[model samples]
Structure formats: C-alpha cells, structure tokens
Target: MKEFLTDPHQIERESMRIIQGHLQLDWTEQELKIVERCIHTSGDPSLEPVIRIHSQAIEAGLEALKRGALVITDVEMVRAGIAKKQLAQLGSTVECFLSDFQVAAQAAEWGITRSMAALRMNKERLKGAIVAIGNAPTALLEVLELAKDPQTRPALIVGIPVGFVGAKESKDLLWEEHQELPSITILGNRGGSPLAATCVNALIYLAVKREI
Candidate 1:
C-alpha cells in the first residue's frame, strides 16, 4: 500500500495492463477504460457485471466534459480522485457541495440528510455538470428529483453510492422515475467512494489520455 500510495498512477497503469490481458470486460474500448479503472480502484472483479451505463451516457458525458463542464460530487473524496492535471489542461475542475456550511443548516431545517440538502443547495450548479455521488443515496435521489426540471438537469449523473439502505432503491428510482437523465450506475449495494471517483477520473482520463 505504501509503494502504490506514493505513486498511484504507476500502480494503476501497471495493474490495469496485467488485468486487461486476463479478463475481457464487456464494453467499448473507451468504456472499458472506465470499468478497468474502477476494478483497479476496488480490486474487485465481481464489479465488472455491476457497473452499468446507458448506451449514450459515456458519449454524452465525454461531450459535456470536453466542453469544460463542472464535475459536482457528493463528497470530498470523489472530488479529490479526479485527475487535476488533466482537468486543468481541459479547463475543468471538480466540486463537492457536501462540505458547505449552508448545506448543514439547510439539512437541519428541511429534515433531510446533509447529502440531500447539499445537493438541493447546489441545484443551480448541478445544471449541465457531471454529478457524482459516492457515499450517499440521498444525494442521487435528490439529483433524480431535481432532473424533473429541464434546467436543473445534469449533463451526466454517476449514481453508485454504497449501502444497503436506500442505495439500490435510489438507483432503481433514477432508472424508473427519470429515464431521460444520462447516468452511470452500479446496479447493487456493491459500490463505494473509490469506485465512484474512478468513474469520474476514467472519463477525464479518456478525454485527455492521448494529449496528456
């Protein structure tokens, strides 16, 4: 852990090369990078079948990201995992609403989890941005609800929060309630901060790999 911790890029690349030769993930070359990165992040091969994406989500996400849209996350860890060097070159950055002081105040007032309140507070910013929720199902649920407004809709939603309670239900609701929103989702409780962050980083990596 110490060796890789100091240089994640080297570890990630080396691991992916080894893993790629052994198991074939079912995705386009572009999409495969994201899956491979997620697996690399979690060290979980079982996630190959669980990570789900709409046919057009990647392309749409790529287009939005290429246009230099903001990447909004539910937590700070998700924001931190983004490749800042690559994103800086593209003139984009990651943001998380959860840490804002107003979110806590609003959460208390509204009787909602801070994640949900943070998302609600950032509705304007969420518009046309990439929404990545890693730690909270309430965040995804709020995003799905916000998407009912055409203006509040995100460019792409990464909905793979980890938990048994409301996690599966939140993703299912995103699928059932708002079919119009473009999204990447892990179709079960088997997801986490690393997996969610890797998806965002993967998109950024794909967009900037050749040039970076």
Candidate 2:
C-alpha cells in the first residue's frame, strides 16, 4: 500500500496492465503512460487514505465524545454511536449527532428505485426483483407498496438487518405486519444491515455504467 501510495503512477500502470491482460483489452503505450501520470499527480501522501467504518470505531468515537474531546469520526463512525458515547461520558454539554445521512439517503433512493421497478414489473422483464429487508419498518412498507402490482412480484426477498436499533420491528414489519403481495414470489431475509441497501445502490450504478 505504501509503495502504491508513493508511486501512484506505477500503481495505475500496473492496474491497467492487469486489467488489460486479464480482459484481453488492448491499450496503446501512450495511453498507459497517460493513465500512470494521471495517477501520480492525483494527490499527496499527507491526505488521509480512505477507511471502511465499523461498529468498534463508533464505540471509540462515543467514548471520545464522553471525554469532552473534539471528535473526528469516519463515515462508518457516523452510523455507530461511539462518538455519542464519548460525548456523554465527558459530561460535555455539547450535543452532537453522528449520521451517515448520505448513506441513509442513498439507501432510501435505492428503495425508491426498487419500489418503482417492482411496481412496474420492470425487474421481471429487465433484471429480476430481489427484495432486501432494511432497518426501518415504515421504509420497508413504503418499498413493498411501491413494488406491489397486479402482475409483477419480486423474484427475491432479502431481509438485511440495519444497525442495532429497529431490527425486530423492521423484521416484524417485513414478515408479519404487511400483507403479502401476489407480485412477490420470493421472500428471504439476508439479516445483514443497511449496508446491503448501500451495496444495492452501488450495483445499480455499476449496471448503468456497464450499459453505457
């Protein structure tokens, strides 16, 4: 990683080479050089490397906040309560809320997309419906309603757990609360998290790009 960071140009060249070699795609020497150069000048080492967020980090962040310390948490921490706990521990009068609203919003958007596709039977004709459960019962209901129609049903149902809160309620909502729609042929909960929703959104983007 350090070597790649220091010589990003080399990294890019190596990456392109690997990609081209594996895919049997031809690339001009000049194009490869250009890509390498672009990689090198992209940024400086002092800039922080991206990190995946996790629950432990959130706990740490919460602990920090409790200490009345100025807290800086990564995206993963935002969803976790570490920063909040830290603040509470310190007795600091400061009130702060860490949120990965971007991620949440993205999930919501994907839910909307899924709902739309399910409603229109778009997935049946195009890709296929794969329903994934989320943390929010209300949100799940919304998605289900959107997907419901006379002719189309979801091909798959994924029950992905979202974070620590609302898991049971969300599950109940998906399983027991809502009326089963005829359009949904498959139903299975993945028991993961909202992370699955994020992944689904990313998959959509990839699919679109691949088409383009």
Candidate 3:
C-alpha cells in the first residue's frame, strides 16, 4: 500500500469516500461512479455534478451500446478517453469528426464551430447512437436540433461542453427544449473534456469489462 500515498488518484478516492460517508444521498453504484469520476476529473469534490437521466436512460445507454450502437464524440480527446478496446468487444466503435474536411468547411461557411458542424453533418448517423459532447456548446445545440428529427434520435446525449460562452445556456436549453430525451450535463459553465468523457466511460463500463 506504499504506492497509495503518492497515487495521483488517491485524493480523488478519499474525497469520494468522504462524500459517500457524509452525505445521505441515495445515488446508485453506477451514479456514484459518474459523480466520483467527475470529481476526479475536475478536482472538486464540492462541485455538484448534474445527473439528468430519466426512465432508466443509463441502463438503456448501456444496452444500446452493448448491442453494437455507435458512440460519437464531439472531440478526438473524448474518443481517446474512452476504453475503445473494451467497447470493441461489444462490436461498437468510437467516432469523432473533429478532423473531417466537410465539418470544417460547413463550420466556416456558417461561422460556427466545426464541432457543431460535425454534429449537423452526422444527423443521420446519430440515430440510435450515443453522443458525447465535451468541447463546444454549439455542438450541444446542434444535437438538440437534430434530435427533433425522428431519424436522429440518439440513445443518449452526454452534453458537458466546457466554456464561458454559451455553455450554461446550451445545457439549460437541453433541458428546456428536449426534456423528454435522455441526457446528462454538467450544469453551469463548469464542464470539460474530462467530465464528458467520464460520463461516457461510466456508461460503457456498465456493459464492458475494464481494468478499474
């Protein structure tokens, strides 16, 4: 146990333990994993992470992914964060269009973030997939728009895009505009690639084997 003292994640582990012991909150095992990972990623155990899942969306997301559903990410960092090898065992793949030429062209033409354009361009491909957006608020907005079309109904939307501009507003709109859709967002302007990727990884871990 000598290594535990210097482990980078030790503080995060202790913080979660304290929260779990002090709070009477009735979070499930899976939910607690998300919360702890969020805290670990952000280094703020006090940051109340928002979990807006409904009607067993967590279970649904895991099941959909296990059934070979596509996992689309707004940034390559998110794709990199996920345990793709474990996901591949279920015949699933991680996709990120940050480098797509069409996405860049579309974003430039519309004066929007390429991440948003990536979401827009993949409307058809998004259906029945799990979308995780962690960088641009515009990407969350575009997902909401595409979600309106019956053909673009994603299994779940993990919208924790981080920024000072339009981040909080975009997340609020996700709840206001599409409350019926299953979603998880880091409320306020306090989200990032790490938090978004953590949420996706949590869901994937439910159905896939992983090394801690």
Candidate closest to the true structure, highest lDDT: 1
Off by over 4 Å in 2: 1-128, 134-138, 178-190, 194-212
Q: In lDDT terms, how accurate is model 1?
A: 0.83
Model 2 per-residue lDDT tens digits across residues 137-182: 3334544554565333433333334345555455555556444521
| Cα lDDT, model 2, residue 195 | 37
Candidate with the greatest TM-score versus the true structure: 1
Candidate 2 overall Cα lDDT vs. reference? 0.33
Return the lDDT, model 2, position 192: 37
Roughly what TM-score does model 1 have, to 2 decimal places? 0.90
**Superior by lDDT: candidate 1 or candidate 2:** 1
Stretches of candidate 3 off by over 4 Å are 1-19, 22-24, 49-51, 209-212
Clashing pairs in 3: none
Q: In candidate 3, what are the lDDT values of residues 1-212, reduced to their tens digit?
A: 35545674676567667666643456777776777667667767566545455546687688788899999999999888987877888899999988987777888998988888888877899998999988889889889889888899898999888889999999989866777888888788888888888888877777875424
Cα distance off (Å), candidate 3, residue 190: 0.6
Residue 62 of model 2, lDDT score = 32
lDDT of each: 0.83, 0.33, 0.80
- Per-residue error for 58 in candidate 1, Å, reads 1.1
Model 3: lDDT of residue 101: 76
- For candidate 2, the 10 contiguous residues with the lowest summed lDDT are 44-53
**Per-residue alpha-carbon lDDT of candidate 1 for residues 137-207, written as tens digits (9 for 90 to 100):** 98888888898898899989999899999999898887666668888888888777878888988888788
